[model samples]
Target: MSERKHIKVTYSTLASPDPLLHEYFDESVVEAKAGFGKTFPMYINGEERTASQTFEKRSPVDLDLVMGYFQKGTAEDVNDAVATAKAAFLAWSGRPWQERVAIMRKAADLISERLFHMGAVMSLEIGKNRLEALGDVEETADLIRYNCDAIEQNDNFSRPLLSESDKHHNRSVLKPYGVWAVISPFNFPGALAGGPAGAALVAGNCVVLKPATDTPYTAWLLTECFRDAGVPAGVFNFVTGGGRSVGQTLVDHPDVAGVTFTGSYDVGMHILRTFAQGRYPRPVIAEMGGKNPTIISKKADIDKAAMGVMRSAFGLQGQKCSACSRVYVHNDVKDEFMTKLVDLTSQINVGDPTVKDNWMGPVANMGAYEDYKEFVADLHANGDVVFGGKILEELGNGYFVAPTIVDNLPLDHRLWKQEMFLPIVTVTGYEDMDKAMKMANDVEYGLTAGFFSEDDDEVQWWLDNIEAGVLYVNRSSGATTGAWPGYQSFGGWKGSGSTGKAAGSFYYVQQYMKEQSQTIVG
Candidate 1:
C-alpha cells in the first residue's frame, strides 16, 4: 500500500530537457472494495491536505480506479486558497517586469522538461492517444514561452514628451488583477489548464486552479511544474471537486479577481448569470461547446477531401468541439467522395489507444458512450447509416464506438443539428455555393468550420462568409497548429466564447487589468 508505481519518461523527437516532462506514479496506490474507497490528497495553499472523504479518479479506457483523492476542500479550504493567491498577488503584481519574464521562462522550461511525462499521464487518464497528448503538451509549453517573450519584447514603457515647461512625466505598466482562478474541463485538460495558469502567472497574477474532476492529475502535475520553477509557494494553487460547489466557489469568491473557464455552453451561461447576480462579479472567459461544419467544393480533390473529413469527424472519437460534425459536399462530387469516405472510415481501427496502429480509441466514459450509442440509434431510425452506424460489441470493457458516417440526412435531422460528440459524421450535398454557405451557417453554434477547395476565390468566399471563429480551407478540421493554443484571441462568435479570447493575446488578461489615460497642461 505504501509503494509508488513509477514509469520511465519516454521522449519523442520533439521533447526538451525540462523536468516538467517527467512521468509521475502512485507513490502508494491503494484500492478498496468498499467503505470510504481510496484517496489522493488535494493541493491547497502550497500544501497537501488529507481530508475525511475520498474522491475517486477513474481511467476512461477502462472503468478502473486509476487513483483516488481526498475531497479535502470545504468553504474554509476555498478561503485559504483564495487568500494565499491574494497575498501572493500583492508582491507578484508589484515585481519588476523583467523579473516576471525570468520567472515565466523558468516555468516554460520546467513544463518542457515534463512534456513527455505529462503527455503520457494525459493519455492514460483521459484516453487521448500519444500523438495528441504530446501535441497538447508541446503546444502548451511553446505558448507559455511565446507569451513570456512577447510581453518582454513589447516592453510597453511610456516615454516623456518634449516640452518647454513640463509639469510631470509618466510611465504606465500592465498590472495584475490580484487573485485569478481557472476552472478547466476534462478534454485537453493539460493544455487548457496550462494556458490560463502560465498566462496569468506571467502577467503577475496569482492563480487558484480547479481541474476537471475526471482529469485533475494533469493539473496537479502542472502545479508541480510551477513549484519546481520556484514560483512563490502561494502564487499557484490546485483543487479538485464537483462542478456545482467548486466551480461556483471559484466564480463567486470575493478575493478572486478573474476566472478562466472552458466547458459546455449551458454551464458557461449559468456561470454568467450567477456572476451577474453576485456581489463581486469578476471577468469570466469561457470556451463553450460548438457544432462545427466542414465544406467540400465541387472542384476539390476527392481523395484528400474524404480523408480530411474522415479524420475531422472520427479523430479522438469526435469529442473535440472543433470536430467536423457537419460536412457539406458539392453535388457533383458527393457520390464519389461519399464512397471513398465510407471506405476510408471503415478501415479505421477502433481499439485501445495504447495500440500504435489503433486509429480511434474509446469514448471518455460510460455516459459519453451511452450518449453516442443513443445518437447513432436515433440517426439510424430517422435516416440511413451509409457506412458505420453501430458500436463494436466485441470490444469489451472500454467505451468503443465504431467510426460512423451517415448520409441522406436532412438539415433538420437531429443528427445534423445536434453536437454529437461521437464518431458520427453527417453529410449533406450542396448544388450551389450560396446554398452550401447557407447550410454551413445554419447552426447556432459556430466554433470551427472546414473547407476543401482548389479555387482561391471560393476559399476566400467561404472564409469571408463562414460564421465560425476558426475556419480552414483545403485542410481537415483537426489541423490545429502549435502557434494556436485554441484558447488564444480566437473564440467562437455565438455560443462558443464569452469575454474575448482565452490566452496568448492578452484579451482575457487585459479584462482583469484596468486601463486609464492621463492628460496634463504644462
Candidate 2:
C-alpha cells in the first residue's frame, strides 16, 4: 500500500476507506490464520517464560477456530513479574525523560507499521469487524503517541517554582511510581491494553500487563512491538491466566506501586478496595463499565437521531463501556425514530467479522453469549421487542445474536438502570425535557451520553445538564461511541471511573507520577 493512500483511520472517521486498506487486511488475515493454535509464552524480565500448564483460546467468531494456546500463569508468575519490574524501575525511571519519550514513540510507530497483522489478530480473537478492529489498533498507536506528546509538551512535568532568594533554588518535579499493573478487558484489547501500558511506561513506570484470558494473543502481539522497540529488560512484561490466580496476585503484590484497570464495576471496585487495604493507599486508575444513554428531542433531525442511536447501541454488539443502552425520545417523534432505528438495525449483516462484508461478529465469550440471551428474555417478558430478539443459529456455531430494541419498558424496571453490556437497548417516550434529563442522570454511571436537538437552547440545556464525561450532540457517526485519541478525552464519572481525569487528554500521563518539591540551599 502506498503511504499516500493510507487513510488515518479513527473511530468516527471510517467512512469510504480506500480499497487498498482492505486488500492489505485481507492478506494479513490469511497470513495470520496460517499460524493458528501455536503455544505462546508470558514475557518476564524481557524474556519469554512458560508455565507448566496452558489453556486453549478459541475465536468467538467460530469455536472451531483455535486462535492460540496461552500459558495459564500462576501466583508465582505474578510474583516473578512484579519483582522483575521493581528491580528494573530505578534504572528505567532514572533515564532522561527525552530518552523514554523516544522509545515510546518508536514503539507507537512499530504498532502502526504492524497494524494490519495486529488488526487481523484482534478481529479473529475477539470478533470485532474489520473497521472496528483496525480502528482499535490505530487508536492504540495514537494513544501512545499522544501521551508521549503530552510529556514532551509539559517538559517532563518539571517546572520552576518561586524561590525565596537567589541562593535558594526551588522546583517542582513529577516522578514515577515503582511498578504499575495494567489489567485490560477483552473488548478493544489492543487500545485498552497498549494505551495504559504505554502511558505508564512513558511516565517512567515499569508495566506488568495482564490481559483478559480471551484475548492474550492480541496482547502478545502488542508486547512484541514494545520489546522490538528496544525497551530495556524487565521494563515491560506480559502475563496471562485466570483472574482468581494470576490477576488477584498481581493486584495484591506489595511491590506494585499502582494499577490501571478497565473492566466491570465490581472488579474495578474490588481492585480499588484491595489496593487501599495495603499498609498505605496506592493509586488505582480504574474505568468501569457504563450504561450510557441518548436523548432525542422533538425538534431533532429524525435521520441523524436514528442513525446515531443505532450505531452506538449495537456497535461491537454493545460490548463497549460507552455503548448507548438507553434512549429517551420525545413522545412526538418517538414512533418515527423507532421506525428508522428498527429499519437500520434490520439491515446489519451479522456473520464472521473477519469477512469484509460483515458489519458485526459475535460476543467475546460464552459467558457474554449467555448473558445476552438472559437479557433478551427479560426484555421480551417486560417490554415490547420491536426490532430483533432471536439467536442467529444459522450463522455457524459462533455466538451471534440480532441487534435488539425494546420499547414501552416501564421506567421503574431494573433493566433500565442496569448495565446489560450486550446488543440490546431499552427505549422510552418522555413528554417533558426536564423529566427526560432526570431519567438520563438517574443511573449511577456517568461515562458517556448523546443528545439530538436542532434547537440551540435545547442543545445548550443538554450540554449543561448531561452528567457524562463524554458528550455528543447531532453526531451521525455514533451517539456515545467513537472517542478518538486527542480528539475526545475518554473517561467517566460517578461509578464509571475512579479518577476524574480522562485518557487521551492533557492531564492523563501525569496520573502515573507523583509530584515532589525540590529545594537546594546555598
Candidate 3:
C-alpha cells in the first residue's frame, strides 16, 4: 500500500479524489467478492446472535450475486435489543461527557481507517457508484466527528447562569434521553444509521439501529467499527428484519426513549404518530423523502444550471431525498437549458457501477425498477420525454434504467408534487420568477431547492423566498445534492422532516438529549 494523501471525500469533494482511493477501493472489491454468501449475525448485548431463519441480500448490480445473508430478526429480537440498550443506558450515560466524546472520536477514526473495504461493500450492496459509495462512508465518519466537536465546544451543553446571591449556584445541563432507535433507509445505510447512532451514543444515550432490508451489509460493517472502537457492550445494537416486525417493535417499545428515522414520508409520519401515541410524547427525529426542485432564472448561466440539475437529478439514480426531481426554468432560456441537460443525461453510462467507466448503476431493487417503468409510461401519455424514458435491458440482468428527462409536464400533474425517488426529472417553463418560486414552494416537501442566477439581486431574492431547508445557488457540483457534515447542515421543512433542525448543524446534537436546569445552594 502507498502513502495516501489526506483529501476530504464529501459529496462536493468527489470531483478530485486522490488516485490512491481508486486503487485501494478496487483492491478491496476483489477481497470483498471472495467472501460472498457468508451469513452475518445480529449484535445484541455484545453477543453475535443468529435467528432461526436468515434472509439473503443480493446485489442490485447482479441479482444472481448473493452479497451476504443476514439474520431475520423478529419482534422478540427487537424486544431483547431494546432491553439491552435500556439496561446499558445508565452506566453509559453516567460516563463523563469527555470520555464519551473520546470513544466516539475513536470510532470515527476506525470508520476512516476501514473506508476502502466499507466503501466497496456499500457499492456492491446498494449499487452506488464508487465515488458515491466512498462519499457516504466518509460522510458518516465526518458526521460523527462533527457531533463530537459540537459537544466539546458547547462544554457538554452546560451553561452557567447569573446567580441571585454569591452562595447560590445555577446552571443548565443537557442529559441523554435513554435508549434511541435509529431506523435508516436503504439509499444511505451507513451515514443515516451511524450518524444518528453516533450522536445518540456521544450524548450519553444508547442506540438500537434497524437498517433497511435492502442494505444490511453496509450497516453491519458500520456496527463493527463502533464495536471495535470500544463502544461498550449493549450501548449500540444492530437488528435486521422486516419493518413491520422489527422496526415497529423498536418504535413501539415503551422503554425506548427516542428515535431517529430516515425513509419515505408515509413511513416517517407513521413512526412520528406512533411514537407520540406512547405513554408520553417522546422525541422523534425523522427526515422524510422529498420532491425537491430547482429553478433556473433567465439571468442564470445555462451551462452551470444544466450541469447542476443533471448531477442532482440523476445521481444515485435519483433515489436521494434531496434529488432535484422538478425544474422550473425561465421560458427565455428553457430551450437552451433543456438541450444541455439532455446531452449530459444522454452521455451517462448505465451498468454495473463497480466498473470504472460506468457512471450510473441500477436502481436499488425491483420495486424501484418497476416504479421507473410505470413513471415513464405515465410521462409518455401526459408529457414529452426529451432525453430518455426506456429501461436498458441490454445492461445485464440487473435493474438498470436510463437517466430520464421529461418536458411540458403540466404543473397541475401529480408527478410534479410527488416524490418518485427515481432518475426521472420533469421540466416546466415559467414566464414569471415569482410564480416559479411559488411553484417550487407549493409541494408538501421542503427538503432542498437549487437556483441558478448570475444577478446578485436574483440570488438575494432566492435566498429570501426559497422554502426548502437546504439551498444552493449557481453551483455546478450539484443543484440540491452534495450536502456535507460541517459545510452544509442537511435537514428539511414541512412534510419533508418532522423536526426543523438539520443534521450536521450546531443544533442537531442537543436534540438527542434533554436539557435540565441544575441549581445548588452553597
Candidate 4:
C-alpha cells in the first residue's frame, strides 16, 4: 500500500472553491442524473436482491429532480441479512487481525479515491454544499483508517498479563461479537455510518447496515467500497427501508449480538431499553442528539465569537447533532455579539447546493422545513426574532429557510431548551458567568459545548462546569462544531450517547469486542 497523504482538512479549506474539486463535482452531478428512475437494489449475502416494494428518492436541492428509486426492505429482508451475517461470523472473526486491517485499509483507500463522486451524491440527495459534502466523505475515509490504525497499535487487543506462578500462563484476548446492526441517520450519511461500521468490521464482527431513508445513495456507495475491498460475501450487507419494519427488525432480532445507532434521543433510548430485554443484555452503542451551546465572555474577542457561533449554527442548515442551537453571552457583550452574528448570518448565500457560490443550502426535507416555520412562529410569539425569521420560498423548489436568530426568550422556554435541528439559534444574556454555566448545563443533553473566553480562570471554570462530551475553546472555525475522527475522538455525555467512549479514540474498538481470559498450565 502507498503512504497516506496528509491534507490540512478543515471546513474553511473545503469551503474555498478549488477548480479541480469543482470540476469533479460538476461532472459527477451530470453522471448522477443519468439513471433517475432506475431501481437501486439491496445487497444481501453478496447478491443484489430487489425488494417487494420500492420508494422514490428525490433531490432536496430541487424537488423536480429524482435521485433514484430505492428498495423498501422489510422484516424478512432484515432477518435474511442478519442470518447471513450470523453465518459468516465465525469465518470472518477467525481471520487474523493483520488481514482484517489490510482489507479495511483498502476500503479506506477506495473511499478517498471516490470522494468527489460521493460528495456530489450527498450534495444532491441531502442538500449539502460541495465543501460540507466533501468533508463528510473524506472524514469517512479517515475514520476507517483511524480504526485500522487502532487495531494495529493495540495488537488487536491481545495482551499478556502477569501470571501468578511459573506453571501458568495468562493472556487476555478481545473476541468479536457475533453480529452487529449499524443503523445510521441522514445528517451524516458517509462519515457517521462508515466510521462505526469500519470499527466493528476491523474488530472482527459481521454487520448488517440499514441506512436512513433520506440518504441511502451515499450509504450504498459506501457499502460498495467495503465490497470492492474484497470483504467476503455475507460479512457485510446493506438493507434500506423505513424504521418500523426493517430497522426495528434489525434491532430486535434475537441473533444480533450488538448494535450501533446514530439518531434521535427517543429512538436511541428505545434501542437501549429494547436491546436490554432480550435473552441477555447486548451492547448498544448510540450517539444521539445535541442541543450544543456557545458562550461569549465580556473579555473575549466579540468578532471571533460571532464568526464561530454563526458558522456552527447555520452549517448544513444547522441539522447537525452538534450544531450550536443556543448561545449565552455576558450582558456587557450581548448587544455587540448579536449585531455581529446577525450581520454575518444575513450574508450567507442560500441556494442550490450544486451551485458553487451558495454557502447555505435547503433543509433536508419538508419535515425540517415545516419545523423551521413552526419554530419561527413560536419565536415570534415568545421572544424577539432579531434576524432572519422567514422561509425563503423564492429560493426554488426545495425546503429552504433563512438563518434565524432570536433574543429575550426566557431560559425556561422550550425553544431555549429543545433541540430544533434547523438553521436557528437563540441568544440570551447573563450578568453572571456562573449563572450562564448553570443555564448551559440545564438541558437533558450533554453533547458538545464551546467557550469563548480570554480569562484563564473563566476558561478553566467553564471547562470544569460545562457538562458536554466534546468541548471546544475559542475555535473560530466552529465553536461548538467540528469534531474530527482522530484529533477529537467525538462522543457525548448524559443523554447524548449510550456509550461515553469517544468514537475513533483509544477505547472505541473495545466496544465492538468482548474480552476473554486464557490460562495455560504445562
Candidate 5:
C-alpha cells in the first residue's frame, strides 16, 4: 500500500470516490485482519512504556475478534506525560516556525503515503465504510496540510501591529500554550486526533493526545506518522485508558495548559466548567455533538432532498455530530419525499465496514448498540414508524441495525430534540416555512443545519436565519453531512460547542496559542 503511495487530493464538495480505492482498501483489510492482535503501550517522554493493567479492544464487526490490547493508563501516566511535555516546551516552542512547518508538512505527506493501511485500521476500529474510512485518513492529512499552509501563508501569524513609530515598533506573535491535551472522538479517530494535534504542534506547543478508548489503533498509526517525521521525544505523547482514569486526570492536571475535546454535550460542558473554576480561566476548545436538522420546502426537489438526507442520516450510522437527525418537510410534498426517502435508505447495505459493497456498517460498540435499542423504542412509542424499526440479527454478532425513519412525532419530543448519534431519524410535515425553520432551531444544540429549497428567497432566509455554525442548501450529496476541513471548518453554536470557531480553518490553529504583544523602543 505504501509503495502505491496514494497521492493526496482535496475534496471541496461531496464527490464519488476513486474506483481504485476499493481495490486498495480490500487487500489492505485482508492483510490487517490476518496480522496478530497488537499490544500498544503508552508513549511517554519519547519512550513506549506499558502499564500493569491493560484493556482489550474488540472489533464491532465480530464480538470475539480482538483488535488489540492497550495499556490502561492511570493518573500517574498522565502526570508523567504532562511533566515531560512541560519540560520540553521551551525548546519546542522556541523552535523556528519555518522548521516546525517543515516537520509538520512531512508528517502530512507521510500520512498520505500510508492512507490505505490507516484506512484499514479505521474500518475495523470505528465501523466506517471503506470509502468513509479512507476519506477520514485523507482528511487527517489534509487538515495538517491546511494548517501548515495557513502558518506559511500568514507568515507564521507574526505581523506588525500598526507600528507606532520607527523608534517604537509594535508587533504581535502567537505563542504556544505549553502543553495542550487533545481528547478526540471515536467517529473520526485519525482526523480528530491528528487534526487538533497538528494545530497545536504546528503552532509550537507540545501535544499529549488521548484518543477514544475504542479507536486507539487508528490514532496509533497517526502518531507513528508524526513520530517518523522526527518530532522530538517528549514533544508528542499518546496514552490509552478509560476516561475516568486517564481523561479526567489529564483535564485536572496542573501543568497541562488547555484542552481540545470532541464528544457529548454533558462531558464537554463538564470540562468547560472545570476549566472555568480556577483563579484564572484556561482555554477549552470543544465540539460537542448536535441534534442537527433539515428543512425541505415545498418548492424543493423532493428526489434530490431525499437522496441527500438518506446519505447524511445513515452514513457512519449517523454517528457524526453534524449528521442530520430531524427533518421537517412541507406538507404539500411530504408524501412524495417520504416515499423517496424510504427507498433510498432501504437500498443501503449494512455489514462489516471492511467489505467494499457495504454502504453502512455496525455501531461502534456494545454501548452504542444498546443506545440504539433504547432510542428506537422511545421513537416507536412516540411516533409512527414508517420504515426500519428492527435490528438485523443475521448480520453476525456485530452491532447492526436497520436505517430507521419515523414520522408524525411532536417536534419538541426529547428524542427529536436530543442527539441520539444513531442511524435513526425523525420526520415531520409543516404547512408554513417559518414554522419549519422554527422547529429546526428549537433544539438547544445548534451545530449543523440543512435547507432544501429551489427558491432563492427561501434559501437566503434559511442561510440568514438558521442558527448553526455550518449550513448547507440544496446539497445533493448530504443535507447536514460532509464538512470538509479546508472546505468547511466544522464547529457549533449554543450548547454544541464551547468555542464558536470551526476546525480545519485559519482561526482553529490560533486557538492552540495565545497572542502576545511585542514592543521595542530604542
Candidate 6:
C-alpha cells in the first residue's frame, strides 16, 4: 500500500583476548553499500598474505558488501603450502601419539576459552544469529576435544593369537596419513573444517586448509588457535582463494596424501574424478549436498508437525545440506496443516539476525538469492503460491526472500524433486501412507528424511521405506548433537553422497592408513 524504503544496518564485531577467536565486525543500519571492501588473509608456509589477485565477497542480506578483496591463491602458492605441510608431516607423524594428543587438547582448550569471540565472528561473517553461532563454536570445541580423547584412548595395540606356540607374538597400531588437504564450504564453516582438521591433527597428520572464499576469516582465527597451542608453524596451513585453481592445485598435487571436502555434489564429483585421473590416487572424504524430505501423517499432531517443519525449512535460511525442504502431508489434514504452516511462515521475522525477534536472515550470496527466486518462479508457474512469494525490497543490498509455502503440485514437479537451497518450501498431498512413503523415496537424494505420526506402525513404515542416511520420527530432521558428530559415516550413498558410513567416525583412522600385522617367534 505504501512505498518501501532502505534500512541502514550496523554490524558489531566481537573482540577478546583469546588467540583462538576474534571480535565480531560492527554493523549498523545505514544505506547498504554498493560493494563491500573487506580483505581476507591467506596463510601459507607459516606466513599471512593478501595476494595481489583478489576476489569479491558480498553478503546476500542486502547486497551490502560484506567483504571484498579475498586473496586468490596461485599455483605457486598452493605448491608452497602443500610442500610445507608435507615436510612438517614427515616429522610430526613420527612424534609419539601422547605428544600429539597433548597438542590437540591444548588447541581444544584454547578454542573453548575463545568461544564467544569465534561465535561472534561466525555470526558477523555468516549472518547467523548469536545463539546459533554460539552453538557452532561450542560444537567446534567439542569436536576438537573429542578428537583429542579419541587419540588418547586409541593406543591399545592389536594382538595376534598363537594357537600352538607359546613363543609367538603379533601387534598393530594406528598411524597418520602424511599430509591432508582440507577444503571446506561456507555453511557451518567452523564445524566442517574443524572436524576433519582436528581429527587429522590428533592422528598425527599435518593439514593444509583452503577455507571458502566467502568466509575465510573464521578459519584464519582458528588457525591462530593452533599456533597458540604450540602446533608447529608449518603443521597447519590456511590458503584463501578461488576454488578453481586453488582446489585443483591441492587435489592434483602428488605429494598431498589425502583430501577432505564439504560442498555441492557436482564439485565433489569433479574433485574425485580429478584425483582418479592423476597417477597418484588417494583417499578423499567428501560431504556433498542433500535434498532432505519430510512427511506429516493424518494421525500426527499437526501443530507440532508445523513447528518442526518451520524450524527445519527455515533454519540457517535453509543453507544446511540437511535442511528439509519437501513436505508430504496426508490429504485428510493437508488443508488444516497447511493453514497452520502458512500462519507460522507469515510470523517468521525476516530481518537482521542480530535482532532478538528475527528467525530468518538473508541468503549467503546473490547467486543463492537468484537461485531461490528462479526456483520459486518455476514453482509458481506450475502450482499455487499458498503464502509468501516475493522479496522484501526494503532491505537494501540484502537479498531477503519471504518464507514461501506452495501447494497443489504434482508428484514429479521440479520443485518437488530438486534441491532449492533457500527458505522456500513446497507441499504435496498423499491419500495413503504407502504412496506417501513411495513419493518421499523417489528423489535421487538420500541424505535425510523425517516423519510425524502417533502410530508406531506408521513411523516404522516411514523408517523402513525412507531411503536416507539419517531418519527422524515425530521430531524435526535438522536436530543433531555431538554423539552424531554432524559427519556421517565417511561417505553417503545414492545421489546424496559417496563413500560409506565408514568415514568421518573415529574409525576413519583405518581409512587414512593401512593396518599392518607383525608376528615374532623366539
Clashes of each: 12, 0, 0, 0, 0, 29
Model 3: per-residue Cα lDDT over 1-522, one tens digit each: 665554457888777888877888888899899999999999999999999999999998998999999999999999999999999999999999999999999999988888878888999898899999989998999999999999999999999988999998999999999999999999998899999999999999999999999999999999999999999999999999999989999999999999999999999999998999988889999999899999999999999999999999999999999999999999999989998998888889898888877889999999999999999999999999988899998999899999999998887899999899999999999999999999999989999999999999999999999998999999899999999998899999999988899999989999999989889999
Model 5 Cα displacement at 46 (Å)? 1.2
Give the per-residue Cα lDDT of candidate 5 at 520: 89
| Candidate 4 C-alpha lDDT tens digits along 1-522 | 334233334455655555566767777777777756678899999999988789999888889988888999989999999999999999999998899999999999898888777888999889998889988988999899998998898888889989989988999999999899999999999998999899999999999999999998999899899999999999999999999889999888999999999999999999999999899989999998999989889989898899999999999999999999999999999999998999999899999987888988899998988889999999999999999889999988888899999999877799877889999999999898888888899998989999998899989988989999999988888988887877887899999988889985788989999999999987
Assess the local accuracy of residue 200 in candidate 6 as a C-alpha lDDT between 0 and 100. 80
Which tens-of-lDDT digit does each residue in 1-522 have in candidate 2? 455345566887677777888988898899999999899999999999999999999999999999899999999999999999999999999999999999999999988988889999999999999999999999999999999999999999999999999999999999999999999999989999999999999999999999999899999999999999999999999999999899999989999999999999999999999989888888999999999989999999999999999999989999999999999999999989999999999899999998988988998899998888888888889899998888899999899999999998888999998998889999999999999999999988999999998999999999999999999999989999999989999999999999999999978989999999999999
Off by over 4 Å in 6: 1-39, 62-69, 156-164, 476-491, 502-510
Positional deviation of 263 in candidate 1, in angstroms?
Answer: 0.8
lDDT of 5 by residue, 311-360 (tens): 88998999999899998999999999999999988788999878878988
TM-score for all predictions? 0.88, 0.99, 0.99, 0.97, 0.98, 0.88
- Shift in Å, residue 217, candidate 6: 1.3
Error of 2 at 468 (Å): 0.9
Kindly give the stretch of ten consecutive residues in candidate 5 with the minimal lDDT sum: 5-14
Per-residue alpha-carbon lDDT of model 1 for 88-192, expressed as tens digits? 787887887688778878877777666556766676667776556766766667667766765676573223444445665443545677888888888778768
lDDT of 2: 0.93
Tally clashing residue pairs in candidate 5. Answer: 0
Candidate 2: pairs in clash: none
RMSD of 2: 1.2
From the highest lDDT down, the ranking of the candidates is 2, 3, 4, 5, 6, 1
lDDT of prediction 5: 0.88
